[model samples]
Target: MKKYKLLWLCTVLVCLTLVFVGYRAKAQTFNSDLPFLIHTAESLNGKVTEWTLFTRETVHLASNKSWNQKTKSLHKQFPNMAWTYVKNRDSKTYTGISRKNNYVETIKLLSTNVNGKSYSFLIYEVSGKHWNDHKVENLNKMVSSQLDKLYDKKPVIFSCIQGHFSDKIDNVLLYEKNRLLKSLQAKKVEALEENDFYSVSAYSSKLSQELSTKKKEEMNVQIGLRKSGLGANTNFVIGTPIITIEY
Candidate 1:
């Protein structure tokens, strides 16, 4: 009886240890940029107008034959999407686009030459113009999983979520700027660029990706606001590690 009890206790301990280690590993790998971007945009009473997630990674192939083979393998991963091949003087690209009622997804496998050196890159982007928040989370997970399988090393990821208010706030650019900073819990503003019509602020967020150093400042979150030409509406864009989309 004593031996059986000891074995049971040992088994429990081992199982708990395994669970804890697995949880830690998962927590380390999980990216929180998209979720937090959505949450923050929604908190500001702005409806989600559009969001895009992009990733690019460089790959190496021994020969043109291997490059073709790699392209074929990548196409197999997205069998449902139709692919279009475009070859230029200096580059070759295979672009696949899939469309749904609410969103669109585009994937590109490109090989090009620069300064007499050959380079290959894989790019995946998903964008939607509708206001479905639930679908955003699902799309983020799907994209993250796909990228993990495609890249051996960590790829550069850029996420941008855009929203708009139907009626503008007084001094919308500055007003929302302060509100957004507070909501993000960002104490210091790393960078700022503004005009009468629009403004962009950069900050570091604990929930965002690795710090991006710019001019001796460490920043990862980028928020932009532009006054809409029509009505009193104000448009905003939030990105982690910087916003790439034109606002």
Candidate 2:
């Protein structure tokens, strides 16, 4: 009996030590590198979810080397997340999928030349089901906190909309470099010339339809879509608005 008791006690201590070591290792792995901010949003159908994190510094590494390093790190941190690797001529991609909730994370490294200089750009994105909003929010917060270590200044643009067509003219609030430029109300006639940022009177389910040939030829613009109606399932009908923000 005494011998059995001693063996059991020794086994318990070893198990506790291993658990503590693993916890510390996980903590260390997630502590060093993190994203600046995580953008989380749900799809129109709410069937799919998306999270994107942009890093301040661009990654400069050989295509193969970068792919291998990222794959190793992601696999280590998310041991349960199965990973698939693919290599193309100018880009390497690694995608990880969580077994628990079918969450997916993709890391891509693309080789490009800027001003005759070769560069590697890294993009990290994740998507999953929108069933648990709190879980998604918490995950983003934790990931961003880790990425805050590599925080650097970068310009970002954002916009918001207000007012209903029936009550008043719909207004768009635009921000650039974290400063509000102006609030634009829906106009009777869309401007022929493009400004730094502008809103158009166009409404379309397809983003490509909003831009005109002249506008595309003259200026560079990024487009965003905002949909409002009876609900996400409501089809195109009366009072349905699909606002496009071109910046």
Per-residue accuracy of model 1 over 174-238 as CA lDDT, tens digit each: 77777778888765544343442443445544554544333345455666666645455777777
Residues 61-158, candidate 2: write the lDDT tens digits.
65556657756765776576566766665444566555345344444445565676666654444444333444645665654553442223221111
RMSD of each: 16.1, 21.5
lDDT of each: 0.66, 0.32
> In model 2, which residue pairs have backbone atoms overlapping below 3 Å?
34-146, 34-147, 35-147
Regions of candidate 1 where Cα sits further than 4 Å from its true position: 1-27, 131-140, 167-170, 197-201, 204-206, 214-216, 228-232
Consecutive 10-residue window with the lowest summed lDDT within model 2? 234-243
Quote model 2's TM-score: 0.37
| lDDT accuracy of residue 187 in candidate 1 | 50
